[model samples]
Target: MDIFDIVGPIMVGPSSSHTAGAVRIGYIGGKLLGEPVKKAQILLYGSFLATGEGHGTKKAIVAGLLGMEPDDYRISDSFNIAKEKDMKIEFGEAKLNEGHPNSALLRLEGINGNKIEVLGQSIGGSRINIAQIDGIDTNFSGECPTLIVHNMDQPGHVSEVTSMLAHKSVNIATMQLYRSAKGGNAVMVVECDQQIPKEGIEWLKHVEGILKVTYFAGI
Candidate 1:
């Protein structure tokens, strides 16, 4: 096992799972949205909802959405900063069924009408798992540059995406496919060793059968 797994991340926190991990969750959510967040509806689940306020979970999440890192002292004042930036913020409980206790669901809207829903869980030692995006099940740690594609479940779309990445000299470290049902809504989650250019993303968007494309450089 990695040594850091025992030590945890460097963060301002009373608890690693509640504070630092929660920050990472919000941070990843912000990155997925790929724009300035204008509004956020954060849903806390299980243990998070029970004692998050006392543990600074709420502030950490807001701080993360504002692009602050876990160690950012500004985390304590994130709500004020969000207010100054005119970002609307709200918090509520999530009725998660068979979900991890240290999990959250983030619904975020950007200034330009972009919106994304992210479900993230803090497993332990400040490491987190992005469980879902826009209701599509996904499994990525946000440890590497990731490409998420929402598309129709049709033939050849998978090859098309992989081929595009290959043409750009991007090497896929890991790739996963999830679908709502056969020949229905689907998502392609790819973690890459190399950074993908903006042009590559645009190309993926215009590919026939592709619905939406989102990219996140590892946090």
Candidate 2:
């Protein structure tokens, strides 16, 4: 673990779980949605639903939906500001096992009819995980522009995508490649240090064996 993880991320906080981790999860959820979350249904599961109010989880989620970072001063008034921004928001309980304590499920709908679903978990010290994006199970922390590539399970596709990123001077942080069956289907969660260009996107879209390319950098 990095020093930040030990001491915690530089952020506004009455509690790291409700504030920083919640904000990060919400921010990543917004990013996964691919646009501003005009309307959202936030379901708090397990620990989040239990102690979320005192930790300001709801307010932190709203802050993230409005594009405010955890360190931003605006996190305190996110609920009031959400109204001014015309964002419709709701809070409720969720169905979850005892897997992760700070878990949440977000159903976000954008203005352009783009719909997305995200399930995230805040472990501790203000860190979280993006467990699932849409129906794909992924392992990413949402610290970068993550590319969740759904493709036919085949050889050389990973190299091709990595080679493209290398040509653009983009750096990959952590990559997790998973397959349900041989030559059937696969998923690659590539987190990058830089934003992906449209040209790169077009290239990846047409790559042989690649079925879908869902890129989520930031909201």
Candidate 3:
């Protein structure tokens, strides 16, 4: 374990899991949306839903949706900031069949009409695990430049993505694959050691059988 594991993240917080981790969950969700967040619906579960208010969880999430980091001084004033920006936000509780206790689900709509749903969990020390995207179960830490590809489960698709990354000289740190059913929807979660070039990502979008591609340039 490193210093962060020992001391937690540098953040404005009453609790690392409730505040800092919640901010990160929001931040990643906004990034996945790929544009400024115009509307957001956040659902907290377990501990977050029970006692998150006193820990500044709501404001922290709004701050993140507004592009603020965990250490942002304005986290406490995020509601006002969001109001000033005309960003609409709503909060509620979530009932899930299975998930970590410190979890939240975010439905975000971007200014450009783009939308995304993210389910994230805070595993302490301000670390997070993004469990699902758009209803697809996934497993990836947002600690690295991550490439999320939604595609048809077919032959050559995996090789195609891997080959492209190989050609780009981007090394994969970790990768996970998930599918709804055979020949159905599939998702590729690739955490890479190097930043993927914008053009490469654009090219991947047009590939046949590829439905969607979302990239997160690490925090």
Candidate with top TM-score is 3
Clashes of 1: 0
Candidate with better lDDT, 2 vs 3 = 3
Candidate 1 residues 1-219, lDDT tens each? 878767656799788889999899999999999898999999999899998989999999999999998889899899999999999998999888989998899999999999999999989878899999999899999989999999999999999989989999999999999999999999999999999999999998998889999999898
Error of 3 at 164 (Å): 0.7
- The list of candidate 2 runs beyond 4 A from truth reads 4-8, 152-159, 179-186, 193-198, 206-212, 216-219
TM-score: model 2 vs. ground truth: 0.84
What TM-score would each prediction reach against the true structure? Answer: 0.96, 0.84, 0.97
CA RMSD of each candidate after superposition: 1.3, 2.8, 1.0
Kindly report which residue stretches of model 3 are placed more than 4 angstroms away from their true locations once superposed.
none
Tens digits of per-residue lDDT for model 3 on 1-219? 687678656799798899999999999999999999999999999999988989999998898888899899999999999999999998998778777999999999999999999999989878889999999899887889999999999999889899999999999999899999999999999999999999889999999999999999998
For model 1, the stretches where C-alpha displacement exceeds 4 angstroms are 4-8
